[model samples]
Target chain A: MSLVEVTGLTKVFRRPVKDPGFRGALRHLVSPRYRDVTAVERVDLRIEPGEAVAYVGPNGAGKSTTVKLLTGIIVPTSGEVRVAGLSPHRDRIANARQVGVLFGQRSQLWWDLPVRESFTLLRDMYGVPDSLYRARMKRFDEVLDLGSILPVVARKLSLGQRMRADLAAALLHGPRIAYLDEPTIGLDIAVRDRVREFLRQLRDEGTTIMLTTHDLGDIEDVCERLVIIDRGRVIYDGSLAAVKDDFARERRIHLQLASPVPLASLSDRLPDAVVVAGDEPGEFTVTVDRFRQTAGAVISAVLPLAEVVELRIDEPAIEDVIRKVYAGELRLA
Target chain B: MMEYEADFWLLVLAGLLQQLVGLAFLGAVFAQVQALHGWTFTEAVLLYGFASFVFGMSPLFFDGLWRTAWLVNQGDLDYALVRPYPVMLQVSGSYVGLQGAGDVVVATCMIGWALSRADISWSPLTVLVGAVLLVSAVTIRVSVLAASCAISFWLQAPHSGFAFAINQLGTLGRYPLTIFGVALRGVLTVVIPFAFTAYFPVSWLLDPGRYWWAAIVTPLVAAYSLILGVRIYHRGVRRYESAGH
Candidate 1:
């Protein structure tokens, strides 16, 4: 059976429609107006057990709204959302026991208390057994290095260290599913890698994961399935490789040669491959169809004419693909 | 069911120290003369004990009243609304301030000394009655402050306003409500109801007023404010601007 089954999921928020200024405000005091803001509209998605799916979208693209609906933070306007065969809104306590959620910008840890105290509070709040809590704490220390940071208050930790502790706090309940909204935002590269590694381990242990982030590297390294939304609707849902390749038939290979070369001279050598763009010396951005020429074939062909010191692959970034999806150009892969 | 002895001690000690200063201030004036009220200096000690005990108990058990502003700013109140327990109960138990427990012990010690000099009699049944009324008074004060926090969520005013008002109410709460005229008396009884939280309940148990029902009605009145506070909280959540929303 599927761990999560969401069909025709929709959410609408009624926002106030009052105009600005004192006169408009005075008029609203007597009788207020309202506007309909469709946060998540008609989104159909399904996830089987242990699937690590990434939900991505631009700002105001209904990504966070969809998450609130799924986690039972807000009630949906219409349609059904089920996790582990229960409506999240109807059986929130029972459902909350089975799932864990963490919002990166907002913390679940107590602000004034030490991180270790917050973890102890959660142990009782979630009814975690003493043996299991101890076991999980040891494992978290190994994975996240939580020992040094445990004594520090949450308000004192850097954004990176805080995210690590929050990850451990969320998983101590032994939930079957986890939702992370931008868990790596505003963190250094090393911290981001550790968080991604921790997530990979969680996924390997058969935990269904749902993630939303603007970082393309996070998408590439951690997520298996992809769902893209734009302006309150799902635009594409498929594998990560499929989403990356869906936008173009060819990949761009950028070449960095050792010496400066004339643009016309480089273009003439590889007539089929265009010298589309490049600015630096010893660098040429070449566009070629992978079907027609292999990267090695192009490298062998270009190495003779120019002194090739380094070579690099230039595939379209996940950001560019999402921009197009927001523009209503891309479809399900 | 929840006995927070560690938190309770911290508050009780703090309350005792603050009341000791009040005791000294009154003693300095009375040293020149004899008695200001009907009773001697010892009776004044009993009133101070009663005031500090009620104040410390309310803050120690229901310290989350101070944190409502944090919840409002952070949008954490939404988590409380979806739970099964009473919203006010959840708000009160969410935090436990240790300092307030320290004050409670001081108040208890003063009460013992007051009984030694003051011409007062205490039976088991009367003591039990007074203790019950004191418990009700704590609930009333907590609910009033919580209601103040609840209403400000919609006003978008900084939580500082409600906090100042709570402290002001508790400050005025230290005095006997009957010494004031009809206007302030009515306001304390109807508009804010701080008198019920401290003055009326304690006085009824101490003097055994004909209005003994005030002790019974204290919790009931607080329950009304709690219901209204919850209504305001739920209404605010529907309009709350959550993080990055």
Candidate 2:
């Protein structure tokens, strides 16, 4: 059975509709008005054990809302969600033992407590054995370099340090399933890489992970499957390789000629590719469909026009495809 | 818990000074009149001391309830919800107020001094029952505060305005219930029951013949308040919508 199952889950928030300023506030106090805002529509999802699924969407696309629903932070307005065959909202304590959660925009650490103290408190709260707790802490320190920040208070730590500590707190109990929402957000590249590496290790250890992030690098490095949400609905769901293959077929090839070659001559030589002028007089860029033509094919065609000095192939990144989707430049169903 | 070591002591000292000033005010009132409504100066002090003691004790243990509104408004309750413990227990035990120490000390001294001066025959059984009744008073106080603070879930504000107002109402319990008109007396008895926190237990202690029933029912009132408080808090938690998108 799948570790996580969600069926037709929807949440509609009743927001108080208010008018402008002080007068409106007084009027609202006398007679309040409300409107229903559907945060999550009928959404269905399933994740098997040891699977790493990237849950991605633009802002306000209901990614956080869906995580909240699955984690039992909020009750669903309709449908059902089960983690480890137990209803998360109905059996919260049992579900809690099975799942670990981290929100990038928030910290679960006790604000006034030191990082080590926070971990110890969490250890007690989750009833993690001493042996396992020590082992996990050692592992976290080796990977995340948590030794220096462990003695520092949570509020005093920098954003990167805090994120690292929070990651430890969330995973201290060694839960079977982990839900990380934007864990790499607001983190520097070095810290982001460390977190990504930790997630990779976690996935390799047979932990089911549902990662919600906007960072395409995170998706490429850690997740095998991709799920894209838009406007409280899933627009696309499939494998990461499939998304790259289907939408990111276009590749760019850059070439520097030993002699200055006219753009028209290069266009004539490579009829199937789109030839464009490069930054310098002796440079030219060739856009090709990898399916229709290869970099070797395009390079050989251009070699005859001028003495080739250097050549570089730019494969399309999954980021470009996902960005296009976000910008409405490309549509996927 | 020791994170606020200096601030804790400072706040405790401030609380002690505040209670001393309140005791001084009670002294001034008694100086003007020998007795008000058949209760002596010592009896009034006992009632006031009981109220202050309970008020102080609540913050030392259950001070986290005061942060309920802020947590709900800021979406901080998300952490507690995902944890393996009861949300109410986590929230109520989140912080300890140092000022409670001062309240407890001053109130204890007042109760001790008043009992010594007052002409009341004491026995081992009566003392045990009195101890139980005092504990029940504190429970009633804490539970009522928790239930009032839980109203923040519905208000959706960042501060416990309703709880603060209810706490202000508790100040009235420091005096005899006879001082208030019939409407407020009814409110303190049936609506919120602040009277049970101070007046009833102390009255029963001072005059058992007329008010023995007050001492017997104090435990029941405490139980009812505790049940109501826990029920309201959990019900409010169920309605928690969590702020932010």
Q: What is model 1's DockQ versus the real complex?
A: 0.15
The segments of candidate 2 whose C-alpha lies over 4 angstroms from its true place after superposition are A23-31, A260-271, A279-282
Local accuracy of candidate 2 as per-residue lDDT tens digits, A294-326: 998987887887888998989999999889988
Model 1 lDDT per residue over B18-106, tens place: 77787787688679757644434666566667767777776677788666666667767544533333445677777776556655777
DockQ of candidate 2 (2 decimals): 0.73
Chain A, candidate 1, TM-score of 0.90
Superposed by TM-score, candidate 2 places the C-alpha of residue A295 at a distance from the truth, in angstroms, of 1.9
Error of 2 at A205 (Å): 1.1
Report chain A TM-scores, every model: 0.90, 0.97
| Worst lDDT 10-window in candidate 2 chain A | A299-308
Report the lDDT of model 2 for residue A287.
94
